[model samples]
Target: MFLISDMLVRIVPLCLYSHTGYYARFFTYNVIGGIAWVAVCVFGGFWFGNIPIVKNNFELVILIIIFVSVLPVVFHLFKRRSENKIITKPLAEVVEERAN
Candidate 1:
């Protein structure tokens, strides 16, 4: 909670400060990350409590939190990449047409 919350506090406002609609984007993304963190923590705690390898409870919790934080960021990046691909395809085709 603390790590995510700290990131939210820093990122959300910074994004907002840059432009108008950034506040909305910031809130929406932070909420999504928050929800994912909650879900992962709940499931990990209940399912893996007795795993001997992750014996220390705190370490297990931190690992779960980091995973939650990272996974969503990766997903977001992948989505951005796909969106960029969609945008660039038409522009590339136009440039090719001009070249021809």
Candidate 2:
């Protein structure tokens, strides 16, 4: 799931760079970055998994971790929605206001 999300985040930049003829550099950097990312994730999980609390309550810990991670995304979505509502004006209202 993390890898999929990471790939999704990279897709836009990859497409842009590829279109602009930087595919080779992008590919090289992406490979190196991907390896480092995987290594860190694996090592971090291995280190964390050895904790007695985590091992005892693995499921609860993962659920809490997931919920915590999702909080920022939820907050961002709500914030963006509020900003859009505040900034957006109806076209007819805009035109009428402009004419006045």
Candidate 1 TM-score versus the reference:
0.35
What is the TM-score of candidate 2? Answer: 0.55
**Weakest lDDT window of 10 consecutive positions for candidate 2:** 82-91
Give lDDT for model 2.
Answer: 0.93
lDDT tens readout by residue for model 2, 5-69: 99988698888988999999989999999999999999999999999999999999999999999
Task: Tell me the whole-model lDDT of each prediction, alpha carbons only.
Answer: 0.80, 0.93
**Residue 88, model 2, lDDT:** 73
The candidate that wins on lDDT is 2
Estimate the overall C-alpha local distance difference test score of candidate 1: 0.80
lDDT of 1 at 70: 100
